[model samples]
Target: MPRKPTNIIYSANEKPPAGTVLILGVQHATLALLFIVYPLVAAAEAGLSFDDTQLFITSCIIFMGIATLLECLPRPGAGMLLVQIPNMAHMPLAVQSLAAGGPALYAGMSLVAAISQLTLSRFMRALRAVFPPEVCGVAVTMLGVALADPALRRVFGISGAITPDLDLRYALVSSVTLVIIVGLAIFSRGMLRLFAVAIGAAIGWILAAYLGVAPEPNASFATLPYIDIPHLGWPGVSFFSWALIPAAIITGVLSAVDMVGTVVSMQRMDDADWRRADLDQAGRAIQANCLGDIGTAITGGFASASSSAAVGVAFATGTTAWRVGAVSGILIILAAFSPRLIGVLTIIPSPVIGAILIYAAAFLTVAGMELILSRRLSDRRIFTVGLAILTGLAVAILPGLVGLTPEWAQPILESPLSISTAVAIVLNLVFRIGIRQEASREVTTADNPFTVATEFLEYQGDLWGARRDVISMAIPVVAEGVEMLLDTGVAPGKLEVRAHFDEENFDVALLYEGEPITIPDHRPSPEDLLGDAHAVARFVGYMLSKRADRLVLGTDGTREKLTLRFEH
Candidate 1:
């Protein structure tokens, strides 16, 4: 059962009121700046020239705008509000390619990866069933967990010779800025909450300017060329740098978690009729995202993925208007014409950007955990999610582990996201035997947990050709037991309902980690209906005895298990 969504001022596919569009669009544009930081940092580490870095940034900015427009548009995209940019999953590969060959090698590798991802559009529907919310959640969390350190570096303002020292002032500015963003988002009820990042960043920039860590307002932007063209020659691929092929393939596959995870978040925010992953819509979104990046091959640009910063802005602003996507694209394209804007974006206080990245990463990581935990944490899911996350984090953080890998394999293995996603998917299939056998699941709403239970039974019914009428009859009495269970204020992720079949009977069990309580045969008193939780449980037990064939109460260590058997 899904809880009715609250305070939904705008949905992912719907347009906000026209009056609010431009403002939301501006916030979105500001958020899009967060995408450039990854590539810029990668370029610095690769020791790219100032000119090559400029071209790289310019290409990515324009491509991000293009991808976003395609996604926001209905013709070929999922028509959801999305912000697209180069994915960080490929940053290590990009750096490797750049160092091994040059911009051409990087560009060529990116082009291949982007195309491979686009091809996934055709199979995303079938693949969606394989990569359920549980697997995707595990991969997404592991990806963010790997990024936490880079975000910390940003907070410290130490990238290279430019800002080599870890400034204490950077910490102060970022901390205060983070407080402002979180505090306003928590306490404010107005539109100000939506602009918390912009507000906090601006305030932090002012503070940072005083501490000599940020640039003061100046007209240096005026000197930027109004109409500059970027034409850095693409590097040539050589036999010596064949390492790029494998890197491209690896990133192309794993980067999809970013696209799918972002769309899932939007769907959650939309509170739509079917919040489950709509594979068709997601495929279109993926294609649109990929189409925007094909230009990088010719123009030496970074490939794109959905932008977390833009999504964060949407949650903060309480708007997911497609218009924001459209207008933000317009702004990004427009921003390209003003060299000053690019300069400004390139020089925004590093710590502020770091704060934004940390918050985005935190949100993504928590969202992944919530997605996985929203279901029954059966042993299969536990091992799949836990092993994948832990193993991925180890590969990402532990240097010695990566060093043990073969030289050519190090690039792909170095990316925790790629490895984690592969592990989660494989483990999901391996564990399906046990998971399908248990047929256990969890729901979020008390209003209709029974509906969920009944639906699940019907599906499990098909496996044995169990009669629909028999399943229908069990629904009413089953509904009562679940209603009572939900009324107990069970903690989230604690309730587990299991449905299975044996011979000629269908069986279901409600399991939770708690003490086994007594269920009374008689109706509970008025006091029981008011504040007494046990009274409701007792009443539910009474009802179950009459409705179910046999109600059994049992305990397995810390868990109290209630089994409801229906024999037709």
Candidate 2:
């Protein structure tokens, strides 16, 4: 098991105090709600009326709450602190659906997306080869990269003109917010660190309000009731359209990619020894999000996915307790009933949101690098990762390039996250061509056992995409075995070192022409170590047994076989 990170005040399984959970939950709820803009944008684009738009937003909030609560449960969820929100990836298709066939079509398509995700979940383990650590790293890094534009634009108040709309005051507010968050997280201790983001954002809000830059909730308070049950506004499943299946499927696949990336990052955050993506947990997460989408479909709302920004907030706060998610879900459901409360939360300053994104982007970028470097980078992998990043970045840097693609291809190329992930998966599969899982080499009497073993294993490790640490452990032991044979004069002329990997266990077999070497379970005594020079061979054999997770010695007809196994 991986050790818990030192900065984590509460892990995924441990429940914090009620007050702490409530505070952290509110923090996450606020972040998740920030994504409410996507559905609101879709409503505006579809030209929905005031009441219709309100119903749409309300339905989205209710389902988001439900999904979040589901995520905190073990059976339906990843059982982590995941908060679901309206996915930006689905906004385009949703707007088109609403424009074409009203809320009914949108809801119908959402069901399609839900089914797509549920189906995708079943194949996650089988698709592990396509989403290797490097590819996942690309997806995670792009998650941060995708946030860069909106974050920087908000921070600098840039409106994309010859003269940038760089407002120094707003920039200062953002800087202050970021500084407080970083300072508290790094320099402070205890409860302060746990509330770093909330404290910083609250302070930023106050500053923005004082500057008259942020709208006060008082202006909208009179327009909304304190509490009222939102109408379900189910558009009825009878309004389905077969023509929109392609768009709905596209939305589902892209949302799955987005959800996968977020879950991968969360897995990394929750476990210190995170090696590869935990597909089983990720599949559960997708299943939970899809169930939420089905509820959204029933209520005539947009599709939803796991919120990467909310994950970042949980990571920054250093408390990913599922109880926090439960509290946050309840709060969100309550907010759905209270329009007045939603009005207040919606008025959070853009600069504050930008500051939080900046903090998250920094952490995610570094975390992605850590995941990428977890394996040995052969030339093939380097190119695979590098080109995938370049292709993904191309879409971000040249947004117009997406227009050149066919209409069907545009959705995949719409964002850095989707484009880069798609390309990385393809590139990883392409580079995997020509590399065999099992290979062997003959070691000569004149050859340096260590050098031959290191070179051969390193090559095979790269080809097999084995974990660097696992291969590092196996190399020394394999070399020691070969050296023991040569030193003990057991094998003469030629010896065969065979390596096999199946993405689980890495086994190395040393085939020679003599009796199997003695592998003692315990350490050799000092008498055996110093009594004779040849006694050192027994000590070497003992060391080999200790290094390998399992060691087997046997004879195959004319040759003796010694095998060293490392569990991946």
Highest lDDT, which number?
Answer: 2
TM-score of every candidate relative to the true structure: 0.73, 0.95
lDDT of 1 by residue, 398-481 (tens): 857888887667766777766777788888777766335447777555447667867776666543334455577667766666
lDDT of 1 at 520: 71
Error of 2 at 499 (Å): 1.8
Off by over 4 Å in 2: 158-163, 216-220, 238-243, 524-539, 554-558
Model 1 stretches astray by more than 4 angstroms: 1-4, 44-51, 158-166, 215-222, 226-242, 272-275, 434-568
Q: Each prediction's Cα lDDT score?
A: 0.72, 0.85
